[model samples]
Every structure is written in C-alpha cells, then in structure tokens.
Target: MKSLFVTIVSLFSLSAAYAQTWSVDKAHSRAGFTVTHNLLAEVDGNFKTFDAKITAAKPDLSDAVFEFTADVNSISTDNERRDNHLKSPDFFDAAKFPTLTFKSTSFKKVEGKKYKITGDLTMHGVTKPITLDATMTGPVMMKGMGGKEQEKAGFKINSTLKRSDFSVGTIPVVVVSDEVEIKVNGEFAKQDGAVAEKK
Candidate 1:
C-alpha cells in the first residue's frame, strides 16, 4: 500500500512540474491603469511599451509567474500636458524612476476562468505586495510574419492598491483616490507544448 501511495504521489509531482511555462506576447498584451478624477469620472491610460513573462500551469496555478516593465515616458492619456505632468516630480518622476514592475508570488483559482494573483509591484522606487483578480478571456490562433503557426491565450486582470504604499501619494488625500485600479489585457504564447499535469 505504501509503495502504491508513493508511486501515485511521484506521478502527480511529475505532472505538476510540466504544467507551467510560457512566453508573453508583447504585441497583443497591455499593462494599463485608471484613476478617478475630481470625484466624478475615471481617467484611463496605459503604458505604450512594456514586456511580460508569464506561465499558466499547475492545476492550482501554484507554478505561475508574472513579471513586467513599462517605459515611464510611454505613458499615454492622449493629452500631452497631463501626460507630461505625470512624469514630473510630483508623480512618477520619470527621470529618476523610469520603469514600473510586478512579479507574482501566488495564484489561486476562483471558479472557472477566474483567478486571483498576488505579487510584488514596484513603482517610484518602492515595492509592495498586491493582489489582482484575473479572468481567462479565451484563446485564439495566429500566424507569425514568417508564416509560423501560433496559439494565444488571453486574460483580463483587475486590481486596486493604495498609491501611498508605493509612495506616489502626494495629493491633499481628500481629492485624489488613494487606491489605483489596474487592468491588464494579457496574452501568452505556447512554449512548444501545453503545461499539463495536475498535482
């Protein structure tokens, strides 16, 4: 009986080890955020250029990983002045801290297509732990420029955090929302094979 139990456990472990590993496709993915303005409406914006590394494996998403970096100057709001101001000392201070980053520490499945990701996010030279809810949008097929067949998976992640945690809090505290909402339109490409194996 013990031998059988050990064999089963070993097989499960082997299966789990093969489940997660992927390369993020920058072209179809996004790292964006929205903040409330004057207590009325939310202003939407995004980082024009960035890169991500992600993996979706392990039945529990225990082997998942996420990392991304954005160019400070690439912030887009379709308005020049406001965009410039965001790069100023009062806000992002682009010249000093030119990039923002996030690295996942945990992932939990919540029903079908729904997941919760907890990770460390760094901005303004500060790092803090944050959790975001993500949903698998779907899958698609694409052809590369060289005619190579490619498969893509999409996920939408949403999360909120207090700006002060990363030291971006500079407003009167009453006017600006302490919490910032982030949305990610993320896509991942298969790394040769599926991450299959449940442990």
Candidate 2:
C-alpha cells in the first residue's frame, strides 16, 4: 500500500512541475507573410484574425506544444481586389477551406534562446510538414489592470514553404513565386491558475 501511495504522489508531483498554459494575446501577436509579386518585389500581408494556444514545461519553450489557426478570409494585402481574388478558388478557396492551421510535432532546443519547431501545416485542404526556425524571448513581469503582476513571453518564428505544396494558387514562379515566407510573432500572457514560478 505504501509503495502504491508513493508512486501516485510522485506522478502528481511531476505533473505539477510541468503544468503551464499560456493564452496568446491577439492584440500583441501577428501571423503574417511575405511573397514575391510578379517577381518584381515582395509583398507583405497579415491575417487579421487568429488564435493560438501554447503550453510549455520551461520558460525557454524547449518542449512546448503550440497550436495555431488563422481565418483564411481574414487575409489582407491592402488591395481589396487582390484580397478578394485570393479568397477565390484560384488561391485559398476560403469558402471550402476557411482556416489554416498548424499543430506542433516537436519543439527542440537548438541553442541559446533558439529552437527548431516541426509541425504540420494545413491550408487549402492540404497538409504538409514544415520546420520553423524560432526564437523565444522574455518572461517579463508587468503590472496588470488590477495591480497584479502578469507574466509575458514572446516568440519570433520564420519559415518558408512552396505554395504549390498546399495548392494555394496555380500561378507559375515567373509570375508569382511559388514560395511563401511566413513570419509569426507572438506574445502570450500566463493565465490564472499557473503554479509554476515565472521565469
């Protein structure tokens, strides 16, 4: 009976040590992209609506789990005509595939403050595995509205993938490059009920 009790206690302790959940602050976070337009210059755009849930065992996010989704219809490139066209069947087909998503398969520490995140990205009714180079920074404390201290963490990610892989568009490389570069900047606030010490 004592051995069983001890084992159960150890399990609970381990769980407590690793329990940390963070909610992304959308107002302070951005999921955007840059792509070559007509092979003349790179155009930038952002998705206005997105959400992410992140959990980590450490402040550095070495073994974190991240799930992110963006509304396909929220894509904007400053041109209404272009944006509308992107949502058509020629590109995202937002009517059929309303969301683009990513769920992490692994977050491995590469060096100081840098990590390699591998995940499957689904868009335009297709899924493909992609690796992102990411950097984690900050666990800074700031006073909240109620005068309570809030812990904030930030992450920067960069990745590039071939649009053809997801069948986003039929345009050739000469017209609009097949490769798209993704930039993700996220700020997460530690939610209530977090027992782990902020780092």
Candidate 3:
C-alpha cells in the first residue's frame, strides 16, 4: 500500500512538471485569410481583434489545448466599402454574430516541429470541423524587456475552408471564391500563473 501511494504521487508530480499555460501576445500575433476575387486576384483580409491561448501538457505539444476567438466586426480588407459589406448581412452580419471562435480537439505531433491540429471552427452561427497544418517553434527561454527570464513560443498554421460551409456570405462563388485560405501566426508567452495576464 505504501509503495502504491508513492508511485501515484510521483506520477502526479511528473504531470504537473510538464504542464504549461501560454498566453497569446496579441500585439505580435495575427489571424488572416485570403480568397480569390472574381477569379482575377486574391483578396487578403485580417482580423484586428483576437485572442488565443495554449495549454500544453507535453513538451512536443502532442497534448496541447488551443482556444481562439476573433471579433467579426474587426475584420479589415483595406477597403472601407468592402469591409462594411462584410459586416452586413451579405457576409458575416457582425451585428448578429459578432465573434468567430475555434477550440482545438486534438493536437498530434506528425513530424519534427510539425503538428496536425483538428478543431471546431465557429463562424456566422455555424460550427464545422477544420484541420490545420501547424509548425511550432521555440518554447525557448529568453530575457524580457526588464531582463526577466521569459519563455516564448510561436506557431504558423495554415488551413483551407469552404466559405459556404460556414454560410459566411450569400454571394455567388464566381464573385467570391468558395474556398478560403486561413493563416494564423501566433506568438505566446508563458503565463506567470495559471491564468493569462491581461494587457
């Protein structure tokens, strides 16, 4: 009985040692998308307001948990009219559904520094499964502005989703391509505590 108790305690301690919570540095992160417009050129857009975090229980990120959200109203395309239209009922309808979110279900290491992340993406009041090819770099410790040691990590992820799958717009595919390519570039800092630090 004593031996069993010791083994259990040791396992618990090991688990705790491997767990880390990372807070997204929004200032250094971006979530963007691209789609073909009129079959002539690609239109690029980005969400200005967003948040994301990661809870990694393993060093290789095989058991990492990811959560992300972006404000639909913050979408920008560098064109005022197009941006406004995106906020209208013809597209995202920001007034009704103001946020798009993603929650990761699985993060599996596929190769060195590469992972397959599967998650549910919710947008325009619709939820669909999406998979991203992710490359993670560095949980390396470095000195911060004040010379305090900090741990940081970054990820570059790409995924393709059908706009119609989420019912994003009523426009025809010829005008705005049905397929959208998403890119997420994120930099995260280790949380000082269990909760993320507010900027």
- The lDDT of each candidate is 0.80, 0.88, 0.90
Off by over 4 Å in 2: 1-18, 194-199
TM-score of 3: 0.88
Task: Show the lowest summed lDDT stretch of 10 residues, model 1.
Answer: 54-63
Runs in model 3 lying further than 4 Å from the true structure: 1-18, 194-199
lDDT of 1 by residue, 1-199 (tens): 9999999998867766676566777778888888888887788889998888766554334457777789988999889998998889888899999999989998787888898989988899998888999897545678878999776667799988888888884985556677788988888876676665543
Better of 2 and 3 by TM-score: 3
Name every residue pair that clashes in candidate 1. 19-195
Local error of candidate 1 at residue 124 (angstroms): 0.5
Estimate TM-scores for all models.
0.78, 0.87, 0.88
Clashing pairs in 3: none
Residue 98 deviation, candidate 1, in Å? 0.7
Residues 1-199 of candidate 2 have per-residue lDDT tens digits of: 9999999988767666666888999988999999998889999989999999887766655557899999999999999999999999999999999999999999998888888999999999999999999988877888878899988888999999999999889977888889899999999987777555344
Residue-pair clashes per candidate, as listed?
Answer: 1, 0, 0
lDDT of 2 at 54: 83
Give candidate 1's TM-score: 0.78
* Candidate that would win on lDDT: 3
What ranges in model 1 sit over 4 Å off? 1-21, 56-62, 137-148, 173-175, 193-199
